[model samples]
Target: MAGEELKPSTVISLADAMQAYSAGRYAEAEDIGCRIAAVHPNDPAVWNLLGVVARMTGRQPEAVACYRRGIAVAPDYAALWSNLGNALKDLKRCEAAIVCHRRALELEPDVATSLHNLGVALTAAGRDGEALHAYDAALAIEPANENVIWDRALSRLRLGDYAGGWQDYEARFGRDELPKRDLPGMRWNGGPYAGKTLLVAAEQGLGDGIWVARYLKRVKALGGEMIVECREPSRALLASMGVADRIILQGEPLPAVDFHIPQCSLPGVFTPDEAAIPTEPYITADPQERARLAPIIAAAAGERLKVGIVWGGSGTYASRADRDAKLAYFLAHFNIPGVQLFSLQKGPQEEELKALPAAPVVHLTPHTADMFETAAAVAELDLVIMTDTSVAHLAGALGKPVWVLLCRVPHWMWQYGRSDCAWYPSMRLFRQRTWGDWTGAFDEAAAALQMLVLQRSGKLLTV
Candidate 1:
């Protein structure tokens, strides 16, 4: 529908554009929005809508231009300002977005959306205190609003307001429709399903599965034969959890059960008073896996320090912009002492890794099946360093001494201002000092590597 030429003389012809956008035809939305913006060059709303379409279609620069054009046309339009702010945010232009949001609020004082948005932009820029105040302002107007509430909660958590944060975090379920146990209805947290079958299925990502698997033990503890299911890639790892009586892979419809519950929601269902995150590293690797790979690793003489490394996860483009590190951050210490850093690279970061020198890296890339093989190789590693990727989880599961490079806005599970993973006691976190700054994380990690080298040689170096 966005492909249709603009037929606007007075009113904006945004109907087809909206339709194309809803149908996920990003290109079509961009085409129609562009045509409409060209036709009604004076209309700010047209420009704003065009900006939204362009942003969604991944043409970030065009989107920014569209927003600027709208502001020029209707400088007083608060909605246009908010729209512009979001576009700037999408482009990682937080300071500009902050200005736009502030202007929008000055024009429309009761604009809760603007406040909430301003808070997020500020949080992205690492101004947590100001962000909290902004979110607080938004929530004061619209208390029960889920988006505002969840966002505020995130800010609170980021600022270490765990008392308020966990309460808000508990209300997270009604916000989105995550993966669930595909039974007729939702999982029953009620006791004594003595004669009945229930599916406590895995929904969401592998990290989510690992986080949620904590409740499976309680489910099994209650005599519920919970069938834990996630993607095939995580089957081996998920299987090791003693809570799951049976591990099922995704795409295979599970057997009918009396009731179904998403494993992630167990926190909401069971422990409402306090979230004692069952965060001990329960997921483990097979002993046989360790045995099978020992010979292969033992052949590589004891001289070189084997290091397993992962650069990226399946992070979204916006998420990746902040969470991911430049390859140089991981590669700077490649020649530090005798460490041989093997590439456990996955997703889009593969091409970037290929261009780096091969001396430190061993590419066992996309073809590898299961974490066990990865674990098998990791068995030889003196240490592992990874961004918040699945490889970190794998190495942790295997009880490897892992140094996880953390983003400023770390994943929710990591909480705030912590350097070690409570989930995996063996894991340590090297955090970025500034938002999207990997330099500090790499520098700290490099220094830690130097200490580890000295320690391995039975020399305790003072910090």
Candidate 2:
């Protein structure tokens, strides 16, 4: 004991580093991980902890490198392989991620996490059938896994299994990221609401609210006075739709109601048959707002067909990078001789429009006031062309001719393998033939637009 020395301050054990990570002290975890990696370079556990810390801190490239190092040290380590797969999936390298996940499963079969990760990668790669199987396998192992349930629901919805999908979709309310609302009223259970006031609470994104608001009319018909709550930006737009007897902004004190339902839950409750799904638009802009914007848009368009274009949605969306197309693609493709394209895009991505070469495109996003104002502007347009975004839903809800450019695997509402949306009769969908192939979608859209222009000019009878 006379010559014995205590370990250096920089020395850290794998257990200590993991404890720091579990406590959410990511910076400390990263420091400890780096120290451990330096001294015990060949230790797979040290490299794995370093990778997890890097990923948690948004250093995905570093995470990938660390995971690879860990795999090199311990090739048969299933957890290391699975972690690498998750990092690759986050980077949108789904094919590579799928390989990693499969290798992880090969090393250790019957791992629920590996199965779930494999499902996610498969789904992102546009292999919904395989993803569904992976999810089912995961569910078999751990029946109450919320993440797996949610992913399986999305896979089901993508395959157009609405009945089962919507039921599993309820798991979102249980997810920590989307906390369940603690409202005063009783949660509605599809019971008769005759003579009872019902409050429909908003959930998820504005686009989700717009999409599900269609169900309000059905709720209104169920013989109840309905009150709808929405975000402030959407309050004016939802109010104009006239689907509810009263509309309130989120966070406001609510009036007494006999029953309440999250807006998304309406589908599960109503279970509208495929044929019963509403095809007509349920929302419109104020005529005064439309009248006000029509002349302004008409002056900009002259005699050319006015086409409103939105190339992106909110940048904060997890999948926006995949769903959004370059603004240049629209400028290059929508250059038909007799058509004028107006930029209906909002948010930070609108800056990209300024970099485009001189074209017959008018920027209207600057003048748009709110979602209602956007609806007013969309109403003035002869056609609206947009990627998956709120504007697409707004244009469709206003009953305007809208062409939606879709990613290879689009949102659940769009379904799959269809050029027409059941939710919006006036909407036409142009899907990517391959993943991330916006050019193909744009080319098809251009051809459709040419036909639309001919139809408008009386050269073609129908489009």
**C-alpha lDDT values of all predictions:** 0.71, 0.86
User: What 10-residue stretch in candidate 2 is worst by lDDT?
Assistant: 1-10
Q: After superposing candidate 2, which stretches have Cα over 4 Å from the reference? A: 1-12, 354-359, 454-463
After superposition, which runs of candidate 1 have C-alpha atoms over 4 Å from their true positions? 1-8, 12-41, 127-146, 156-182, 190-195, 268-275, 315-318, 326-328, 347-357, 364-368
lDDT of 2 by residue, 233-284 (tens): 7989888876789998888998888899999888777664466677678887
Candidate that scores best on TM-score: 2
- TM for candidate 1 is 0.83
Maximum-lDDT candidate: 2
